[model samples]
Target: MRKLLASVFVVAMMIGCPAAHAVQPDEVMEDAAKEARARDLSRELRCMVCQNQSIDDSDAPLARDLRLLVRERIAGGDSDSQVIDFLVARYGEFVLLKPRFTLHTLLLWLLPPLALIGGGLALWFYSRRRSKAGSATDPSHLTEEEEVRLERLLAAETSDKQA
Candidate 1:
């Protein structure tokens, strides 16, 4: 039983491990530090073909090309930002997994909070109006005619009870 459990656990781990990076062996940089930097930048870049997956995770041809480009730029001694700027210039800002909060993307950042505040204000106003409508039947709010009719009803009830 123990052997079976051990075997099952091993299989589960093998299956659960993330798919190997799509980077080919030949594309690996000679410098380990540069290679690590390239890998990090690749994770930040969106694969043009995969759309949703980062270049590091994507198996698509375009993702592989982008990975190579990043390594080449790193090997050429470009700073991380320079490599990123090169890609952005070539592919536009959509290539970034996380967009910069610039003027163009300002509305994207602000929209959720604005929507939440607007919804809360609407709910507050609606509840306030609803409570006001509900409280219209309160005795203190009754018209003079309504108050007189209520008094008459009470008097009639008392007289009937006495008799």
Candidate 2:
């Protein structure tokens, strides 16, 4: 039984580790430094065809093309920043996996915290309102008129029982 469990665990791990790279072997640079730079840039770039995935992790044709483009730029002796700038100029800021902070992105950064504070305030108000409503219906807080009516009913019941 232990052997079977071990085999199943190994198979599960194998299945979980799917092949992640889309870069073809031919696109690799001869220089180790250039290849490393290309790989780093690929991880920073968004795959246009697979919007949420980095180009390095995507299997789409566009991702492969972008990977090759990055390698070509590295081989042509462009500095890392220059290669990134060139790609950004061509693809716009959306191609970056993490966009830079700017006036236009201020709302994007502020919205989450604002929403959390607003939700917290709403919950506080709702709980306070619920507490007030609950107190109004509690037996211990009955009005004087209701207490007199209750007492009369109890007295009538006691006299009927005696008779």
Candidates in order, TM-scores: namely 0.69, 0.70
Q: Which run of 10 residues does model 1 get worst, by summed lDDT?
A: 15-24
lDDT of 2 by residue, 113-132 (tens): 99999999999999999999
CA shift at 22, candidate 1, in angstroms? 2.8
Per-candidate alpha-carbon RMSD to the true structure: 5.5, 4.7
State each model's CA lDDT, in order.
0.91, 0.88
Model 1: per-residue Cα lDDT over 83-123, one tens digit each? 99999999999999998899999998899999999999999
Clashes of 1: 0
Clashing residue pairs in all predictions, respectively, total: 0, 0
Question: Which ranges of candidate 1 are over 4 A from the true structure?
Answer: 1-19, 137-163
Clashing pairs in 1: none
